[model samples]
Target: MKDMVTPTMPVFEDMLAAHDRIAPHIHRTPVLTSAYLNGLSGAELFFKCENFQKAGAFKVRGACNAVFGLDNETARRGVATHSSGNHALSLSYAAGRRGIPCHVVMPRTAPQAKKDAVRGYGGLITECEPSTSSREAVFAEVQAATGAEFVHPYDDPRVIAGQGTCSRELIEQTGGLDAVIAPIGGGGMVSGCCLTLSRLGPGTLIFAAEPEQADDACRSLRAGRIIADDAPETVADGLKVPLKDNTWHFVSRHVTDILTASEQEIVEAMRLAWQRMKIVIEPSSAVALAAILKNPEIFRGKRVGVIVTGGNVDLDRLPWSAG
Candidate 1:
């Protein structure tokens, strides 16, 4: 409830500072390519392989910045957050690095591998029903009981600043790009990309990719306001959350467009990445690739950067396994 108030927007400078602040703790995840995939899409696609990041997702960058950027006194209370999965594990990993307690509220339906990863990083997990209201209610209780500093998975300024570092690295690594595409869950990564690319790579167009099953971001963009969705069924579980106020600010202002892909297309893209690029990417990350492949005319002959947001998958619950 407190976080619902639109927080002050983090500027480009904050992203720069966060990039430096979190650089040592996190990986400058590599930019990868698949020549075969590029030929298929008719674009020179550079995949920022955040799946190989410390917590197996790009969420680590934001979590690390939020944890480490805190004052010593504040951080002593440790950190608390609610996530579908990756952010929980990433926040836990960051807190563990800071030698502090981490509390997490995760959806009951979240993949077991992500739950295990959170525990592996020493996060105390509290399960919540897989819905927005439930996650918020459970997280409120966890925050109150633990007296923890809340690090929202995607809404906070520090987290956005941290996420911006991803694009900063992408721009530096690839020199220049015609466009950048990132999945829009709560819009943290795309907002970060918007923030960073607006300042550091102004010429580059920013696109937000979303699952058609949970196309709230796309709808919000078209409606020119935030449109909250309760629960949407999609294999891209990480993308079920809707955009918050802070994230909406960046998304509405800087993002060029929001594109969506069907669940089948998302799965196909995920498998294609694994098969062609030899990289494991979660379904959420596949959303961006799906968008590109589905709309080749928009990306043809352009040098595009796609944020491969995460790689954490439950081996027993692979998308194709559900028959």
Candidate 2:
């Protein structure tokens, strides 16, 4: 595990700045409530539907901020990134809107829907072996070939700040929430969420839901060190990254507790969401909801917020059988 970068109240201010910068560029996804879920969980819940956000996921928020944050010279040259899905779609679309090049290193297992979106947005896609080493190598090759500035999938402060917008809006929408739960992958989303909730909803508990299969973040947080290797495989491909220095830092400081969910639990939660609420969410996104549903006592009688990270699953090969 690596040492965590401590978080502070200043991150809250940076979150505000990020909100102002990207608000015009991204959608203010509606906050929806479910009478059924409230009744079922014995808790009031607000769902931030980033699945309804542009590019069909919250990735666009951070990607747009990263691209737009680039200076004039850099934006003209374009940006490069490596992602399994949503983030690639986001960076490609963002770069397209700016009329610059986007070079993406995509894992072989990346959903077809996401790959097509990248191509449609005119991003140059480079296929990789679907492992950390391959992704890093491909991204390096693409960067060397094109001289495009690297825009990491997560770990960038701009990306973290932009991702934090979800929490800012969540707090503003609900006024006061007892707690907020978001799935932790590379920590961009959780880092951002903690930054805002720490200030506006200081009393609010911040919980990160993670898959037990890919539980590096969970292990690292408990050990108070960063884990950068042996990222165990998970069906939730989106939550595959090892702990990052910046994100682990924020998690150690602001996040209250990291919860673990089984792959079966995540799939069950996804099925429940599609059937009960008619909202399609990725397995990674389902971890947050799984935490809420499978463990009612934790959120019972409290106002809880959940982030619907994405809905861009491949129709032909969804992680779980819909039938």
Candidate 3:
């Protein structure tokens, strides 16, 4: 495993603070182990079930911490963010908890369920062009028009610290993991997960699982640069962002490896998990299982931990299948 950074980043203390700040709002989600999944993957597998988290995904942790940890004046001004789905819902829920209004800038192409969730949670939605470059412009307009504070999706220290608490709880629950694999999109989960493991569980190999079509993180890590995701296409709508500087900054320091999984592999893994394990996993989260299934040798003999990061698959439309 290569050191992803010259100096280990100090994200753990903030994660600890996040754990304390958002403790009452966030769920200490359970760590589930599957004898069948372990045997199938040829490794002892511990699934940190954030799919069961508040907002039905791990986004709420960061969203809650970032929302609640804000000073009263900032909270009073309200908050705004851009997301495909989970982040919007999480932001809405977190803001609702704090008695503040949330403005969510979502891609028009974002899942209808996610859009509905945002509205269901009382979020005010402003639809935008799905591109990263334009989303910022749209958010800026919304923030200015609404006079709302911005809560960045993945690149903020506060949000990243909040996300780290998920992995912290996972490490605490499992105790010893030879390797931990998390699916990466915008790098929030991996950034935080890496920070926690680097500090508390130093020996844990942190692997990032990414969709092959949306393999920007793999490219960014290899090139040590942030690559734009030009005309990206993937079933994992959540894993759409190009790597952020802060995310890549942490990736360079803590990630042990970046693995790519095919669309077919991702779909099959999602189906199998739902049918066999009865776990409804989103395509982004299913990337972890997909990677394990496709390249078993890399993880076969190791004690591996995977974040079943979310369960918010729209259930209306399905991913491409093996048949």
Candidate 3 structure quality by residue, lDDT tens digits, 1-323: 01211133345788898999999998899888778888898988889999999989999998998899889987998998876578888999999999999998889987677788889998999888878677878988887787787777777777888899998898889887899999998899999988888888899999999999999999988887888787689887688787776688788888988999888888888887887777888989999998998888999889998999899866557775324
Q: Residues 1-323, candidate 1: write the lDDT tens digits.
A: 55532378899999999988888899888899888999999999999999999989999999999999989998898889876478888899999999999998889897777677789999988999987789888988887887889888888999999999999999999999999999999999998998888888899999989999999999999999999887799999999998988899999999999999999999999999999999999999999999999999999999999999999887777898798
Please identify model 2 stretches exceeding 4 Å from their true place.
1-10, 107-113, 128-134, 229-231
**Number of the top-ranking candidate, with TM-score as the measure:** 1
Candidate 1 error regions (>4 Å): 4-6, 107-112, 128-137
Give residue 163's error in model 2 in angstroms.
0.3
lDDT computed for candidate 2: 0.82
Candidate 3 TM-score over all chains jointly: 0.92
Candidate achieving higher TM-score, 1 or 2: 1
Q: What's model 3's overall lDDT?
A: 0.85
In candidate 1, what residue range of length 10 has the lowest lDDT sum?
1-10
State candidate 2's TM-score. Answer: 0.91
Over 4 Å off in model 3, which ranges?
1-10, 107-111, 129-137, 320-323
Q: Would you list the clashing residue pairs of candidate 1?
A: none
